[model samples]
Target: MLDNKLTYVVGANIKDEKLRDYLKYTENLSGRFIKSSGLTGKIRVNNNVAKLNHRISSDDVIDIDMKTDEHQNIEPEKMEIDVAYEDIDLIIINKRPGIVVHPTHGYPSGTLANGVLYYFKEKNEKCIVRLVSRLDMDTSGLIIIAKNQYSHMALARDMQSKDVSSKESNDKDLNNKIFEKSYIAVAHGNMENKSGTIDLPIGNPNQDSARREVCDEGQRSITHYEVIKSFKNADLLKVTLETGRTHQIRVHLSHIGHPLYGDSLYGTVESEYIDRQALHAYKLIIPHPRTGEQLTVESNLPEDINNLISKLKSEA
Candidate 1:
């Protein structure tokens, strides 16, 4: 029931500051948003229209309406979607393997985005599907979608500001981050170490190839992993990403000789154990786009992965 509106009460510390300064610095709104809202007459103070230069005092109420008329060209397909979390500002979906997240060149319909659009239509909600993150077609896990432009902007800003490469940080520092993503993966071999970090660079050799590799000229990538359980042939790992390079987990694991089971692109080919890559986005922690409150969402392993683990257990 929450609308596309933002409200703030001026505090003593920010009193007497220009509205533009408060919004740009304290509220973290982008310059584009400020200009657009100002032109659209969506900025108000104390029930009166206000400009970006308006001066405010303590106890002043500022409101910004953030509604949009933008529409997506994607066709809405009626399909079942696993919604893990939803609010007026955003939604988190538990994506299944073998389904693309959005429309692409080769995939135009029957995607998660199409299904989400249909879901919104059914609920009579006027919202666009703005994906904040994506999972590969074979990777099953949580995907975030912002319901409005303002929420998308806020989340995107926070994601860009996150320092995912902080290896020596304490628990408090970790808790202060705006977003955290975790995964569960089954690798081909039993790892020698119980826990470890892989700090490397990943890049594609050419633009025509879909493969990613660790190379000297690549961008910095970091992955931290811990052994959750060991089988005779493979090991279960809880992996946390510091940098979200394309195929970072697969490339880094393969570089360290622990490629994920069934990962044909960067590791071994599909086997009887699993038909797709044995990777799942299991958990996510993010701050509410509007309220700045912490939110954590999780998804259990899919049936194929659970069966794979069972098969591995039997062999042990």
Candidate 2:
């Protein structure tokens, strides 16, 4: 097993006994000559420090080196990106389907992050490409990027759940300050109403597939969807998100029996164009962190989806 050594004193609130607890919590860091030095600048920590409440003061130095089993951390390749709008605050890209947002387990490189990094490097802009939110690899749509850490943190704080107006009363400033996210989804079947809201809770399906499902005990999720186009076997939809969750739209719709056409995990695939799920992040409304202005952005349907719709229409 590889080893990484690290050192750090407990934060101010932590008690003396909790210092060991903090060390044990952090992964990686193992050494033989581990000495617990009194409050010093940038003390080193070892692997076996997992405790809480270790009394540490401000400006305490922390150093840790932990073992990381060699996972594929490869260089990212370049690709084309649909630049919708860009400014110092953020950037919006017309994200496409079948592309992972960031490098992860299965995909270590050639992700959207790689492409965005390349874009910034080409322009010689020394800015960090941070994602405020992410869309799944298979789901295509707009993704918001923050140019710096301040914008990222501010937008993230505003994205937290806030009290929404029930009467549509005044409070316009507060309304615009909070992030309002929206999307468009096409379900496999028609619904009872042309437009309706689903107030359901979402939870991880208690199964081995690692998929999400709708459960009463899960976090509260709300999806507002409207029927866009009706087909013989399927219907195009415009789904707006009142609350964001992992697989929120897909799980909620599948629970109501209107699973998406190309979704294999939640719903069974039943058509020739069924390769990936038919979901897209069509619209996004966010509050400007610096200016506090409202910004709405959207992405059009990709060509493959547009052609699939045309073919489905022709077959019918």
Candidate 3:
């Protein structure tokens, strides 16, 4: 367990501003975050709970409790993790397959969160774990974790903007954009189209086999794909997401009759080469929350996928 309270100092410029405005200006907290925290009684002033409309003054101490979910209190475990990048604000990790991103049913520990917590403990930094995005347990790739609430807020807002048309729209402001994620995958079939876009609506399907499908009532999802290399019976694709949804790449590719290799849930064929879906988050471009500078990080293909590709080439 970790302490969640965050304290802020009122500067000279915003001396008499309302608590809400002060938070927005100094901490980059959003109105939605403020309201959500208010509902949970997470915001306080000088140890007393405060409202969004409460006026703030110079030298007045503001205490805020970071919001957390039910599983945040999980004990840390000393598991090995491949760290790609780390700064005061966030950490980028090259997650391996078979490791769950967070704790869930049948898996209460040995998660990425637990490993990250232990890593932080070793460094003597007591901070709550905050994941910016998640990859499926069987999918290996680059994922980010924020060190504090401020960075989390910025990244979360950027991700949300892709779904809704807000003031933080990418067209309106490029610097405030969240992240652009790129992936590489080995699909089951030889795709006819070398490059194309999948503009389809995805929603819950009636079938028990799949949680989502392309339907009329589904949300609009878009995936851009380009074939990188053609193998004997498969194609390696460089896939990008215009709109991120649950299993967007898997669902979209599967809908096109070319599912990911070894993806039992979506692919028609069972691959003997790999145990899980051959999808890897290869690259990510994120703007720094504080500096607004674009930061690009890349993750290499894991050994399993590399070996599979080598086998395909040798047989070709």
Best by TM-score: 1
TM-scores of the candidates are 0.92, 0.70, 0.80
lDDT of each: 0.87, 0.67, 0.83
Q: Model 3 clash pairs?
A: none
* Model 1 C-alpha lDDT per residue in residues 1-316, reported as the tens digit of each score: 5667999888887668898888887777888888889888999999899998999888899999877776899998999899999988999999999999999999988899999999998998888899999999999999999998788887766665564444323335334655888999999888889999999989887879999889898888989999999999899999998778888899999999988888888875767589899999999988888878889999999999999999999999
lDDT of 2: 0.67
Error of 2 at 175 (Å): 3.7
Which whole-number lDDT from 0 to 100 does residue 267 have in model 3? 79
Q: lDDT tens string, model 3, 1-316?
A: 1345567867676666888888876776788777878778888888899988899888888887764543358788998889999877778999999999998877989999999988988987666788998999999999999987667887877766665334455444543465788999998779888999999998886866646888888888889999999999889999988777888899999999998988888876676599899999989988876566789999999999998899889988
Total clashes for model 2: 28
| By lDDT: ranked, best first | 1, 3, 2
TM-score between model 2 and native: 0.70
- Error at 56, model 2, angstroms: 28
